[model samples]
Target: MMRILLLAVLLLTVACGTVTPPIDIAPDAWISYDHKTSYFVSDAGADSVRLTVKYASFTFLDKSAELLPVAKSVFQRISNELAEKRGTVRAVYDSSKFYESVAYNGVSGVSTALVSNELTFSAKADSSGTPTSAIEPVEIVQKLEALKKALDSGLITKEEYERKKKEILERY
Candidate 1:
């Protein structure tokens, strides 16, 4: 009886004393698509983020419900931006079996491209040991501009340029 009581108290103490570290949200550079769609990226507390995106189609023509060519262009531009980021999506699988969702599982990291699609943005760490992104918005724009110029100059073929550009934009 005494052992059982002691075990209960110990379990209670352990459960009650558990602590969750604080998170930080900061801006990161090298994480760009276009000014119009950049707002979709947001830091989830400090450790993670929620990346929601909508892509565009340049080849698609205007339809009855479709707003206009201008809208289609905008959608295509946004889609291009989103695709740029998607290239870095590494293959990751959950390790935990049953209770994996309840525990903090470490990330598996991102994949590497053969020619490299987008630039790397370093993660920011705060005093409390929280990691966040430190990429700037303007830097992303400049990179996009450079990419666009390279494509326009024929340095990169239309297909290759469009593909790579799309990958950069997809990074949510």
Candidate 2:
């Protein structure tokens, strides 16, 4: 009986040792963000003056093992968006979209939540100008419409369409 128990213990140990390790085991890592704010505005200052708006700071965490795939998928989507426009583009994370997350502790085998956060981004700009506040939302809608049209027309590929569509829909 003792020998059988020892054999069982050894088998269990071998099974445990053969399990795949989690990709990210560290507590801290470098992060990057696509946007600073989800919302942007342009205010009119003078006649025909363009107001350039900027968003706030965003943080990216490199420690999320599960979220890594989600993050990369989002990034690839954004890159596709930029590739379509042939113009400068930026993406930001929707803080409102952030959901609670949980992770299994490697050492304890217990589930733990490593706080989740939001990130946002804006296209790089050099000049600062004011935009008519009244038309800002209208302009955004028109832009979205244009993007949709581009997708339908095949000017932007399907993958690009899906990504940009998701990005825009997240705004609403």
Show where candidate 1 strays beyond 4 Å.
Answer: 1-131
TM-score of 2: 0.20
Q: Which stretches of candidate 2 lie over 4 Å from their true place?
A: 1-135
User: What are the Cα lDDT values of the candidates?
Assistant: 0.37, 0.39
Which digits, one per residue and each the tens of the lDDT, describe model 2 over residues 1-172? 9999999887665433211212332223313334421111222232111111112221232223454345445434543353234233333343344333333333333322222223222343333422112223334677789998998888999899779867766654
Quote the positional error of residue 17 for candidate 1 in Å: 63
lDDT of 1 at 158: 84
All candidates' TM-scores? 0.25, 0.20
